[model samples]
Target: MRNRKTGFILVEALIVVACLVALMAMLAANQHSSMRETQDRLRQKRAESAARSAVAYVFSTLTSATPNSVTLNDNWAQLGGNGNQSFELGDLTFRVQIIDANSRLNVNVATAPQLQSLLVDQTMVDSLLDWRETSTTPRANGAKDEYYTGLETPYIAKLASLTTLEELLLIKGWTAQKLFTVQTDVIQSAITQTDTNNRQLPLIDYLTVDGGAPNTRANGSTKINLGVRGVTLNQIVQLGLTQAQATQVFNRIPFNSFQQLLGVPGLTPIAQQRLLDAVTFTAGNRVTGKINLNTAPSWVLQTIPNVTLDIANTIVTQQSTGFTGLSQLATLNGVSPTTLPRIADSFVVGSDTWIVRAYGKSGEIGTAIEATVVLTNGKLQIQKWDRLNTIGIPAWWNWEEEPTSTTAVGTGQ
Candidate 1:
């Protein structure tokens, strides 16, 4: 009887031991799952915080002063030549870029000739035009509703301004692969010639449709008037001209319109184009779409009428200190008064719209955000905002290798 009782007790003990072991295993699994969830939540919070901080910092810088004053202060230089700047905040590291929208071609506003010069694809350019125009009639190489209706997932043509960059993917013959190939080729060629440190300049970098309506404030107010009585030498200097050229401009002042600046003594057609690219001369405090002379690449400068490659190169080389006025461009080697008028009205000393991209990372988890904002009448308004899966790091980052302390935390811009 005593042996039987001992056996039963032993069996019970074993059974209890097995149950405790199973419970321990289950608890351990639960703990691991909980830990993973916690880590993911922490990473997501960090990413959101980092993105908001970046936007706040950029907007503050943009609105700190007048648009031209911000450029004159050289604040945009903080973003670096390739538009990539990295910095650290708390436990998160961030890579940020601020792109002047005016530095890019406007799909809605660029002429056919200008689009041809930039895209080098007549058919694509024609398609782009057809997509935006209200008419159903196709251009020489463009597609219409009929072409779209034939697709596997048939849809009608947009016949309106593009609301988003992704809309390009829907255009006929604009495959994702083709678009990527073209953009990659263009960026590769540009970096090779310009030594842009192997930075990747995506297609979106060269194009935009946002900058607000030309000559109209975001608030619908009229632009500050520009004329002899309203204009000052200081304002003329903002045209990228030198003090001497500004003085000359002042002498030529009391002018009636922006067109009159083309006739300034010794102002070359190229210089005038540079001025046009950098300033707005119409009445009312309107913020027109104008390129920033301080930031535009030689290729972008070439988009101006009568601005040859050699002339563009001269402008780029002489822009070390950046242009405070359009007259400063006249000091370039080949720029004479004869060529300035042709390019006037294409540029502005300040930027009203900017594309800000920020990347945040913590350990293996990372997130990125891209935003387009416009500054008008001292107010900052966000036009577009999106989160990205990849941060688009440069080739030099060697992402295949293990991240280092500096790379993981990011270096200041």
Candidate 2:
């Protein structure tokens, strides 16, 4: 009996030992997981802080510098330039890019011709017009409230300017995949060319609605300032003049009136009529929403009446120091005198608004902040702010993972 009791007690001791070993293993695993989670949280927090700091830095720099001296290409060289500027704040590294908002089209103020230049789909263009106009009547291929109400999850058409680029998804034909694609090579031929890659250009990259309501002419329409100084000869040729006639027009400058062009020898009646229809001599040069000569793309420049591809390219390349005055553009090699008066009212020397992108990274965690800011008379106002899960970071970072979340950091009117 004594031997039997001793054997049973030994078996009980073995069972207790096994249970303790299993419990210890579980505790060890829990400790490791908790440490990893804590580290991830710390990194994310640091990244967010770094991103905010980067944005602040850009705003401070812009505010302190002379507005006319700040060019999108020069101030934010990393955006499209060969080199990148990055700095470390403790363990977090931050990168920033600043772009002129005037470089993009303002949907609230864009004309049909201007919108047509950017989108290959006439239907999409008409649909956008229909979406913004107060009329219930639709254009030939446009969508109205009736079209949207017929969807699987019915909604009404927003008869107003788009508050966000994502609002296009609610329209008839736009989708997330179609809206964000990049068109690396875009061929601009005509408005109706279906083979063009303009459809692939992301709407977010080219449109804005926030920079204050544009100034309206007495005719109840937005006006382009044509007084911008760099009127090229090609732009003048587009005004119905032959190469010889345009050259004659190029030699003259600083015309106070269209009547002044009559003094140019061999000014034909047809050329005079075309010039009258296209050119405006009013000193209303301070119109709101004019494209910044310092940052507008060559294609956007081509949309101006007289600017051809070659002339537009020349204008972009010659603006290394940025045009402090329109007169500076008049000095380019091929600029025509006739082009100056016609386009004099169309451009601004500096920009009042800018698009700022700031990226922050800490360890494996990263975040991006995109903000649209308006700086008028040195007062800075943030119109839009978004936090992104993924952004095109510099190649040196070796970041390959996809973003985990996309959330709005904040928004303002």
Give the Å shift of residue 394 in candidate 2. 10
lDDT by residue for model 2 over 185-277, one digit each (tens)?
Answer: 334563221112333234455666654312323223333223445578887887678998878877675455554654578876566545544
- Taken over the whole model, the C-alpha lDDT of each candidate is 0.63, 0.63
TM-score of each: 0.70, 0.67
Instruction: Tell me the spans in candidate 2 whose CA falls farther than 4 Å from its real position.
Output: 1-23, 68-83, 184-203, 211-287, 303-306, 327-345, 391-413
lDDT of 1 by residue, 1-413 (tens): 99999999999999999999999999999999999999988987787677677777676566764455234335654642233444567777666667677666677767777666656467888998999899989988999999999989999999988876668888865665544433544422232112354444344446677653245322232333345355677876765677777777777545545557667776655556555444445555545556666667776777666778888888677566666565566667776666655565565555667777766667656676778987766788998888765544433222322223333233434
Q: How many pairs collide in each candidate, listed in order?
A: 48, 14
TM-score of 2: 0.67
Candidate maximizing lDDT: 1
RMSD of each: 7.4, 10.0
lDDT comparing candidate 2 with the true structure = 0.63
